[model samples]
Target: MSKSAVSPMMQQYLGIKAQHTDKLVFYRMGDFYELFLDDAVEAAKLLDITLTTRGQMDGVPIKMAGVPFHAAEQYLARLVKLGKSVAICEQVGEVGAGKGPVERKVVRIVTPGTLTDSALLEDKETNRIVAVSPDKNTSVWRGHRCKAANSKPS
Candidate 1:
C-alpha cells in the first residue's frame, strides 16, 4: 500500500493534536479533514469505516483517513453525540495548487456548541461549546448559557 505523506503544514497540526490526543482530531488538509497515525485507526473503528496509512512522522509510519469538508460537520456531530471530542485544524494561509508550501494552522477548535452547521444542529434545541484553558483563567463559553430558572417542579 502506498504510504500517504504529511505535508509541512500537517506537521504543525500534529503539535496541536498532542494537546487533544483523547479527542478525534479533524486535521484539515486541503479539501479534506485528515486523521493521522493512531487517530485514523481509532476514527475508522468508531465510524465503522476504512483504515489507511500515510507517510512517516518522526521516522515512524503514520496511518491516516479522512472525510470531505462538506460532510465533516455531520461526522463531527456523530462523534460528539458519542461523547468524543474533536479538534479542527484549518489552513490559515492561501495556498493554492502548486504554490509550494501551504501555510496552515489550527484556526478553531470545535467541541460541541461552536458548531455552525444547520444539519448537525437541532432546530428546537440549543447547542453550546465550552473551552477551558490550562491556566484556569481564560474560559470561553460559546452559545447560550441560559437555563430555565422557573420550571414547573414536576
Candidate 2:
C-alpha cells in the first residue's frame, strides 16, 4: 500500500501495533474488535470467520475481519489455546472528540501464561506465568488477576 493511501484510523492502528509485534492486536471499533491486514487473514483462517474488505488503500482493498465484543471471550480462549497472544486496543473517547481519528490504545496483552478468567479456563486446569532463574534451577510464577483492559485507567 502506498503511504499516501492509508487512512488516519489505519495509521493510528499501525502506531499501536508497532509496540507489540508478536501478539495479535484486537482493535476495538464499535461493538466489535476488528483486525486488519495479516492479523485479519490469520484470525479469519483460524476461527473460520468470513474475511472481507473494509476500504481500499492505494487502490487495493484493505482486508478486514472481526468478532463481536460479546463473543470475544470464546475467541480469546481459542487463540490463547493456539499459543497466540492478543493485544486489545480500545477506543478511548467519543468519535470526533479529537481533531483526527477516534482515540484508541492498547489496553491489554493476553497470553497463555497469564490467564485468570475462569470462563476462559477449563475445569481442573491451571496457568502459570513464569520467570526462570539465571542458573535455570528455579522458576517464579506470577499468579494474579489481569489488569482491566484499558490503556488508561478510568
Candidate 3:
C-alpha cells in the first residue's frame, strides 16, 4: 500500500513527526506514550524497552513502542540525559463529528541542552545554556533565568 493508503492515525503521527525530525515524538495515546517509526526503533534500543507492532499499515507492520504516561518523566529524563530531544504531543480536543481523529498537538519539547522543570534541574541557578557576547552587558540566558514566556520584559 502507498502512503495515501495508510491509516488516519499514522497520517496524523507523520504530520506531527515531520515538525520535529530531530526529536523523538512521544505521541500520547491514552495511558501510554507511543513511539512510531524510527523513534520506536531507536528508543526501544536506547531505553531497553520492548519494541512491538501495534498494527499494520501499507502491508507493513507499523513499528511501535511505548511507556506508561505516568512514568514518562523518568523516560524523558533518561532520553534527555542521552542527548536526545523529545516532543510531547497530547490530545488537544474531542474527535468531533464524522470520522475525524482526536486532535493532538506538540505541547513541549525537552532537550539535553535545556531544562526548565525544577524536577529535572539540580543547581537551578548555575546550570544553563546562554548566548554570551564579548560585551559584559549583553547576555542572553535561557533555562529558569529567562523571563516569563507570556510577559513582556519591562
Candidate 4:
C-alpha cells in the first residue's frame, strides 16, 4: 500500500488539488512529487508523456504522474522555464506525527524569478522574470544582478 493509502494528510492534499482544478499543481507527496486528475492530464499533454490514472477518491478516478523528490527542483525549473506557474504543496510535520494526520500546506509557489535553488538555475546566464499587473499599469522585474566590470565594449 502507498503512504497515501493510510495518511489523512495525503487525502487533504487531494482535496486541495480538487479546489484548483484548472492549474497544474505539483503536489508534494513524501519523497516524490505527484499530479492528480485534470492536472495530470494537462501535464502529460504539456510534457509530452502518457496520461495515466490512479486510485479513486470520493468515487472519482484520480489521475497522477510523479518524479523523485530529489529531481523535483530540476523538473520544476523546466516547467517554470516553459512559462508554467506551479504551486508547491509540502508536508509540515515529522514522519511519526500521531495527531489524526500530519499538517500539510502550500509552502510556496514557484515562479520564474523567485526560484532560489542553484541546482535549478543557470550560473552563467540571467534568469529573467516579469510580472504584469491586472490593471495593465504596473509591472515588476526580478533577476540576478549585472556586473559592471563584466560589461563588454560596444
lDDT for each residue of candidate 4 in 33-86, tens digit (9 for 90 to 100) = 788667787777777656677766555666778767788777777787787778
Residue 46, model 1: Cα distance from true site in angstroms: 1.3
How many clashing pairs in candidate 2? 0
Q: What's the residue-level lDDT of 96 in candidate 3? A: 66
- Over 1-154, each residue of candidate 2 has an lDDT whose tens digit, in order, gives 5656798888888788788878889999999999988999999999999899988877888889999999998999999999889999999889878587888988788888777666677655545444533444556544444342323222
Predicted candidate 3 versus true structure: per-residue lDDT over 1-154, tens digit per residue: 4557787888889899989999999999989999998899999999999999977887789899999999998899789778899999998877564576788999999987777665454432435455544545657543333421212222
Write down the TM-score for model 4.
0.64
* 24 Cα displacement, candidate 1 (Å): 2.2
Off by over 4 Å in 4: 1-11, 18-23, 48-50, 113-117, 128-154
Report every candidate's CA lDDT.
0.68, 0.82, 0.82, 0.66
> Which prediction has more favorable TM-score, 3 or 4?
3
lDDT for 7 in candidate 1 is 60
Residues 1-154 of candidate 1: C-alpha lDDT, one tens digit per residue? 2223556555566667778876777877768998877789988888876778676765767788889899887788788767677877777767675554566656656555455555655556555544544544656544434332222232
Q: Which ten residues in a row have the lowest lDDT in candidate 3?
A: 145-154
How much does candidate 2 score in TM-score?
0.80
Q: How many residue pairs clash in each candidate at the backbone level? A: 3, 0, 0, 0
| Candidates sorted by lDDT, best first | 2, 3, 1, 4
Q: In lDDT terms, how accurate is model 3?
A: 0.82
Shift in Å, residue 34, candidate 1: 0.4
Residue 61, candidate 2: Cα error in Å is 1.0
